[model samples]
Target chain A: MNRRQFLSWLRRLAKTAAAGVVGLAGSRWLRAGFLGAEAAPPAQRPIRPPGALPEARFRAACTRCLLCGEVCSAMCIAFPSRIEGSQPPLRRAPGAMERQELAPPVWRGDDTPYILPWKRACNLCMRCGEVCPTGALRPIAVDRQTIAREVRMGVALIDRKVCLPWTRTSWCGACLTACPYRQRAITVDHQGRPTVHPEHCVGCGLCVEVCPLRYKAIAVDPPFAPDRGAVRAE
Target chain B: MILRGWLSRRRRRWPGGARKVQVLRRTLQLLVLALLFAIPTLSLYDNLRNQRDEVGIQSRWDTRLVHRLVADLEEPKALTQAVRGSVWTFKAGELVISDPLAVVDFVAASRVPWDRFLITALLPVLLSLLLGRVFCGWLCPADLLFELAGKARNWAGIKTDVTFSRGTKTAVLAAGVVAAVILGNQVFAEIYPPRIVGAELYLWITFGTFGAGAWFFLALIAFEIFVSRRFWCRYVCPGGALYALLGRYRLLRLEVDPVACTECRLCNVSCELGLDPMGGRFGQDCNNCGLCVRACGHDALNWRLGLPPSGGVDRLGHPESGVAAATPGEPAP
Candidate 1:
C-alpha cells in the first residue's frame, strides 16, 4: 500500500473506533443510570394488573410488548396517557426531545397496564398474566380461590354517606351479590347493609361495576392505601 | 396476436432475469403484509366463537362458510402469541427467539436468566452474522412503505436527496439502548413501526379500539412520504442499525466481477439505500435487497460468498492506482 492508501485505511479505522467508543460510553452511562442510583418513585401508586411484581422490579422486567393488554378479556387493562405534572421516572439525556413523543408517552405508569374499574372490572380471568411474555406479571391459575389469594388489585372503600342502605334511602344488596368472594369478602346483614372485609377482599372491582346507585357507593382504592373504617356492621 | 407479440418483445427487452427477481420480491413483501393483517383477524374470529358461547348469544344467520374458513386458517394460540412481539417470543416455558438489539436492552436493564438469553438472542445473531441485515429487506413492513413513498416521489418528480452520515444510525441505536436502560423499559419496541402495526391490528380486532401509538405510526408514515425518503430505515431505526453492525462483514455480499465491466450506472439508481454496486462499495447500509443486482444488465453484479479485499485493485485488475478506490465505509456522493 502507498502513502495515500494507508492514510485512507487509517481514516476508516479511526471512524470505526470512534463509533465503538461512543457506543461503549453511552452503554456505560446507561448502566450507571440504571444500577448506580434509583430515580425518585412516583407519588401515586397506580393499580397494576394481577400478579405484578413490586413497582421497581416490574418496570425493569416488563418489555412493554403490550401482550398483557392484548390478552385481557375484560378490556379493563389500560395504559396511562400523558398526564400533566407527572413525568416518567426515567430521565432522558440532554438534547433528547421532550415533547416529540414516541411509543409510550412521558407519563408515569404509561406503558404498564392498569385496571380502571369504572370503565371495566377484572373478572379474575388471569389471561393477562398468562400471556405476559416477560414474567413481570407472574402467571397464576384462573381458579377463584387462587385469584382471591394471589391477586390484591386494590382495596374496596365504601362511602356510608352515599350508600343507599347505610343512608336509609333504599335496601341495596348489589355489592354483596357482585363480590366474587361472596360471604368471605363481602356480606349483607339483616338490615341489607353490605360490609367489606378488607382482609379477604381482592378488590377485583366487580362490586364497583355492578353497583346500582347513580353515584358509586363503593370505590376501589390502590392496594397500598391504609385501611379506613368505612364498612359498618348492622 | 399483435398484443401477444408486443408482450413477448417487452418481456425479452430486459435480460439477465432482473424482472423475475423484482416480481418475486414484490410478491413476498405483499404476502408478508397480508399474513401480518390476516393472523389477528383470524384469531379474533376464532376467539369470538368462545366469547359468544360464554355469553349464551345465538345468531340466526348461518355464517358457517366464513367461520370455517377462518378457523381453518387460524394460527395456534402459541404461534399467535409468538407473533405479538416483533423480535421475541416466550412460549411453552421457553424463550423462542429475539432480536439482538432487544436482548441488549433486556440484559442491560434487567436480570434475565442466562438460558433465556441463549435461546432468544442466539439464532438471530447467528443469522445476521451470515446474511447481513437481510431482514430489513425481506421482513420489515417499513421497507414496503418507504418503497411506495420512493415510487410516489419519483412519479411526482420530487428530487429530494437528503443524506446523513452512515454513522448516524449507529449513534441512534446506541443512544436508544441507553435510553431504554435508563427508562427501565423497551421504549424502542413501542415506536418500532412493524411491531406497532401488529399490535394496532391486534387491538383493533380484539377490542375495536386502538391506542395512541397508532397515531405515532401514522406520523412516521407521513414523515417518510413528505419529509425524507427512507429516513427512518436508513438513519434512525435502532433495529436496522444493530443488524447492520452485526452483519458488517456478511457472508453473502454483492460481488462485481471486474472483467465483465460495461460501466452502466443503472445499479446505482436501483439502490434505494444509495449504495454503488458497480463501484463495489457496499457498506453495512446495503440491506442485501438485490435490487441493484437485478438492475445490472451485464450479469456483473451478483450475490457471492467470499470476503472481497477491503480496498485495492482498479476495474482493469491493476494495483496501486493514482486515486484510491472508494471503500465500503465511505458513502456514495
Candidate 2:
C-alpha cells in the first residue's frame, strides 16, 4: 500500500478500535439500565401466564414479541409499560404499586407480560403458551388434568379478615361460585365458610375477580413466592 | 434446461425486463409487511371470537370474513398455531427460523447450549451463507421503511450527505455481544429497527398501544429524514453487521463487467448501503440486492456466483482480467 493509503488505513483502524472500546464500555453502563441486581420481592412479582419459565430465565428467554399477549383469548395478559393516549403510564392493579417505587429489576421487566387479576384474570385457556415461540411459556395441553397438574402460576389465598362468609357477615360464597375447579380448588364448609386448596388451585384468579370486597378477599400468590399457605392457618 | 432456454430467449427479447427482480423484491417486501400486520390481527380476532363463544357476550364486531378465510386455508393451524413470532424468531410449522444475531445474543446471554437453537436457527444461517444478507435487501421491514424515508426526504427537497465508517456497525455488534454477556439481556434487540418495527406493529394491532420502542423507531425515521441517510442500517444495526460477517465469503456476489465498461458511477449512488459497484468494490457489505444491476444503464453489473477472481494482491480482488479472459472480443490477460 502507498504511504497515504497506509496512513488512512491506520486512521480507520484506530477509529474502529476506538468505537469498539466505546461500545464495550457503553454496553457495560447500558447493562445497568437493562437489568438490575436480583432484588425484586416475591409478592410484588406479577403473575406470569401459565407454563412460564421461572422469572429469571423468562426475562432472558422472552424476545418480547408479545405473541403470548396477542393470542390471549381472555385478554388478561397486559404489558407493564404500555403508554396509552399520551397520558402518564397507567397505574397497575390495586395491589401493585407505582412503578417508580418498585425495585429496579421489576421495572426492567416492563416489556414482558403480566396478568393483573384485579383488572382481568387469566382464565387458564392455555392459548398464550401455544403461540409463544420461545419456550418462555411452554405449550401445555388444554385438558383439565394437564392444567391442574402443570399450571402453577400461584395458589389462591382467601383472607378470613375480609371474607364475608369467614367473618359470618351474611354468607358469601362468591369465591366458590367463581372458582373454575369448583369444589376441587375451593370448597364451602357446612357453616358456609370457604376454604382454598392451594395444591388444586391453578391460580387463574377467577375467585379474585368475583370477590365482592373492595379489597379482594382472595389473592393468588405466585408459586415462587415465600410461604405459599400462610393464609391457610389464619 | 427448457426453462433456462426460455428465460434466456425472454431476456434477449426484452433486455430491461431483468428489472423484474426489483418487482419481485418489492412484492415480497409488501407481502411480508402485510403478514406482519395480519398475523397479529388474526390472533386478535381469534382471541375475541373465542372470548365471545365461551363467555356468551354478544359482540357487535364482525368475524365472518376472517373465519371463512381461515377455514378455507389448507391448514388453518399454519397461520394461528405454527406461524408464530416475528422475523426475530419466526416459526412456520415445525421449522423454527431465528435471526442469526438473536441466536448469538441468546447464546451469549442465556448460556444455553447451541443445540437448543440448532433446529430453530438452521434456515437463516444457511440462507445468509448462501444468499448473503438477502433478508436486508428483500425482506426486512426496516429496509422498506428507510427507502421510503429517503424518497420522502427527496420530495421535501432536503439533502443530507452525512455518512459514517462502515466498520462502525461491526463495532456496535461487538459492543452488543459484550453487553449481552455481561448484562444477561438481549440489549441490542430493544434498539434493533426491524425487530422494533415488527413488535411495535404487533403491539399496536393487538393491544391498541405502542411501547417505548415505537418512539425509538420514529426517532430513527426522523433522523434518517432530517440528519442522515440510511444511517441505522449502514452504521448501527448489529444484525446487519452479523449478517455481513457471516456472509463474508458468501457464494453469491455482484461482479462488474470490465468489457461493457463505462464508469458512470450511477450504480454507486443506487446502492442503499453506499457500496461501490462501478469501481468493483462489492464486499461482504454488498447485500446482492441487485438494485445496482437495475440502475446500470449499460447493463454492466451482473450477479456472479462463487468468489470474484483473487487476482494478485489487489485489495478488492477486481476481476478485470477474469472478465477479459472470458469475453471473446477482449485480448486474453
Candidate 3:
C-alpha cells in the first residue's frame, strides 16, 4: 500500500485501540459501581474441587480448558451456567420447573469446577487435579491420607433435626458407612447416633451423597472463613 | 479414483506455486486439527482404562484398531500430558505456547512469570513479526470454518458486500485485554474460537458431549455464514488483532511487480479480505495467503521482502499517487 494509506491505517488502528481501552475501563467501572452496591452476601461458598488454589488466584489462573471436568470420574465437577443470581427462566414445559429444582441448584460459581456432593460426590480419584492445565488445581496423589491432609474441600455439617438417628425417627448409619474414613471420620454413638470427626474428614462428600434423606441430613459447607473458627467435633 | 479425478481437476484449475502453497497450508491446518484431536483421544483411552480398572471391568475395545493406533503410541500419551492445552500449555513445568493477547492480559492483571512468559508469549509474537499473521492463514481452525462458510454462502447464492472498518479488530483486542485485566482472568482465551474449537473437540471426543464454550463457537460460525463473511477474524477477534499489530512491520509481504501487469482485477476479486491487490495496495489486513498472487495470470503479484515499490509510475503508465492507488477502477499498478 502507498505510504499515506499505510499511515492512515496505523492512525485508525491507534484510534480504535484507544477507544477500546477507554470504553472497556469505563464499562467495567460502571458495572463494578452498580453491581457492587446491590450485590448480596453469597448464601454459601461453593466447594471447589480438591487441590484448587485460593478463589482469587484460581480465577486469575484458570483458562477454563474444562479438562478437569472431563477427567472427573464421579462427574461431580460442574461449571456454573451463569453469573450468581441471574438465573434464566426455565424454558421447558410448565410443570418442568419443579423437576428442575429437584435436579440440583444451578451453581453460581464461575466456569471453574465445583463439586455438588448431593448429586455426585468426589471419590478422591484426583484425576481432575492431575489434568488441570493451569495450577488452579494443584496436582496431588490419590491416596487417602494425602487427600485427608491436603484436601480441605469443605467441612461436613450434619443437621440433627433432619438426621434420622439424631431425630429419633429410624436408626440409620448411611453417612458412617459411606464415609471413606469410616470409623476415623464418622462413628456411631452407643445409641446409634452418628457423629462426624471433622479433623479426620476430608469432606469428599461421599457420605452426603449416600445420605438417603429426601433432603440431605448432612451437607458439605465450603471452607468459609468464619466457619473455620468453630470446631464442631474434636 | 474419484478423489484422484477431483485432485486432477483442481490441479488443472490452479496449476502453479500458489496452488502448492495452498495445498501445504491446508495440510498444515489439518495436521494442527489432528494433533489437537490426538491429545483428548489419548486421554480418553487412558481415563477409560483407569475407570474400568477401578470397577474391575475389562473394556473389550482395547484390541480395536482406533484404540491401538491412538493409545498404543506411548510417546503421544506422555506428550499429551506434557502439553495438555491448546493455544497455551504448561509443559515440563513451564508455559509452552500461549496466545499473545492472553499473555498481555495475564501480565496486566498479575505478576508475569518472566521465563515462561517469554517462551510462551514472545515466541509467538516474534514469529508473527517475521511471518505476518501466518497463523490465521495457516493454523487457525476458525479460518477453515470461515472458508467453508464462504463456500456455503456462494452455494446459497447470497451476495453480500458488507465491509467493516479494519480498526474494529484493534478495538476488540484493546477491549478484550482491558476486560481480562478487570475480570482477573484470561477471558479472551476462554472464548477464543480456535481455542474453543480445540477444547470442544477434545471434550466431545472424551465425554461424548460439548461444553458451553461450544455454543459461543457455533454462534461465531453462524454469524460468519449468515450475517457477514470472516467477521470474527476481520472485525472482532482479539487474537487476530494482536497478530495483526505484531505483523504490521512483517518482513515478508505481498509485492506487486509493475512489470507484466494485466489490469484484469481478478486478484482484487480473489482477495477474501477485500484488499485491492491489483492496485498494489495491500494494507495490514492482507493475511498473505497468496490467493491474489495465485489468481494473477500475469505473474505480477508475488511475495517480496520489505515494502512495495515506491515513487514510480505504474506499469499501466499512470502516475503512482499516494493513497489514490487504492481507489477502485484505477488501472492496475
**Which candidate gets the maximum lDDT versus the true structure?**
2
What's the TM-score of chain A alone for every prediction?
Answer: 0.64, 0.67, 0.66
Error of 1 at A226 (Å): 14
- Report the lDDT tens digits of candidate 3 across residue range A1-234: 999999988977886687589769966754442232112112222467988775566667776666686567666676543334322222222322342343334324234676767667888999888866546788999887788778877666676767798889998999988888999889999878887777888778888788897656776655533334243234
Show where candidate 1 strays beyond 4 Å: A1-46, A78-111, A224-234, B1-18, B53-95, B111-118, B307-331
TM-score of 2: 0.76
Q: Model-by-model lDDT, in order?
A: 0.64, 0.71, 0.66
Q: How accurate is candidate 1 locally (lDDT)?
A: 0.64
lDDT, candidate 3, B183-302, per-residue tens: 676667666788777766765554344556666776776677667888887777888878877776677877666667667789988887666777656655667788888788888878
- Provide the RMSD of all predictions against the true structure, rounded to 1 decimal: 13.9, 11.9, 12.6
For model 2, the superposed segments whose C-alpha errors exceed 4 Å read A1-45, A82-105, A108-110, A141-146, A158-170, A189-197, A213-215, A223-234, B1-15, B53-64, B68-82, B308-333
In candidate 3, stretches whose alpha carbon ends up further than 4 angstroms from where it belongs are: A1-46, A70-76, A80-110, A123-134, A139-149, A161-164, A167-174, A177-184, A212-215, A224-234, B1-8, B11-15, B53-83, B88-95, B109-118, B305-333
Positional deviation of residue A177's Cα in model 1 after best superposition, in angstroms = 2.1
Clashing pairs in 1: none
For candidate 1, write residues B251-297 as lDDT tens digits.
78777676675766778888887766777666677788899888877
